[model samples]
Target: MLNGPLLVTERLILRPPAAEDFDAFAAMCTEEETMRFIGGACSRSAAWRQWCTLAGAWHIRGFSMFSVIERSTGEWVGRLGPWEPDGWPAPEVGYGVRASFAGKGYAFEGAVAACDFAIEFLKWPQLMHCIDPANTRSQALAKRLGAANAGATRLPPPFETAPVDAWTQSADQWRQKRKEF
Candidate 1:
């Protein structure tokens, strides 16, 4: 039930999650490959709780990952945006696009908008992308977004054992890189 500003890109719309976005969100959660680096696949009930967590974050923290939507077809593409739950290493602009929408650049497009929202609106001084060691695709994307590998770091509990590499860039760096796009 969170209604926040919609971040419109050329081919996608990033907005707060709604009740209608759940089924697709849950389906994405069940996709093993898609959820591999993102805490693994889960049951529909677990997805519900996870979805609620993201939705509730906006009300409590004033920001959360956005439910990505395709502009032309209005399909739920995936969820991607700012996320920094308790004990997180840093403010992050993370992303996950549905398997069907893979390679379409929706993640990159949405991430750019999300970074802008985070650095400009949310006023975060820096941004990080906590990518898993084996997630090469995300590493490439983070590189393409002008973030550099800042070395390894363990996440907080539940994910404390997860091997993660921190990719980061400063707000000034983001603004300069954004202008080049």
Candidate 2:
């Protein structure tokens, strides 16, 4: 198992998903608002499959999405980490916040931390954030993390449901850019 200390940020805690988190996760996955850009609400079984995939990533790839928690309530606020869609060029740092948490800086904080981990620990050469063109919130977050717009592309095979614009940043680029934040 790829174990490490809980990833902590000023207002968030990024930790492995626990079995008990299924409820919160499932709720988020099923919420219309939360799944708006995720191809609509997923079934409970689909949510479980997603959880298993994240766990598999920890064992197979050494890093996976963390259940984002708010420090104040220790609530499962959303998810943040890297994921490799069926045939993508690289693992992309992805995030999804609950509807209630959407306007907060949690997305920015969690994503930047994940990017830093990939740069400082994983030694990944580059990181990407794929978002639908209509999701200005995520696009802005990518820019905040120093990812430059790479234009629209398919979401790799299997996971391909809609076209998306890709935002990319190299480890070297992130290092330089984070300092400016």
Candidate 1 lDDT score relative to the true structure = 0.95
Model 2 clashing residue pairs (backbone) = none
Judging by lDDT against the true structure, name the best candidate: 1
Instruction: Put down candidate 2 lDDT per residue, 8-96, tens digits, no spaces.
Output: 99999888777777888888998997787765689999999988888777777778888899999989999888777558756789899
lDDT score, candidate 2, position 157: 58
**For residues 1-181, could you state the per-residue lDDT of candidate 1 as single tens digits?**
4488799999999999999999999999999999999989999999999999999999899999999999999999999899998999998999999999999999999999999999999999998999998999999999999999999987899999999999999999999999988
Candidate 2 lDDT (Cα, 0 to 1): 0.83
Give each model's whole-structure lDDT: 0.95, 0.83
Clashes of each: 0, 0
Over 4 Å off, model 1 = none
Candidate 2, superposed: residue stretches over 4 Å from native? 1-5
- Candidate closest to the true structure, highest TM-score: 1
**Lowest-scoring 10 consecutive residues by lDDT in candidate 2?**
1-10
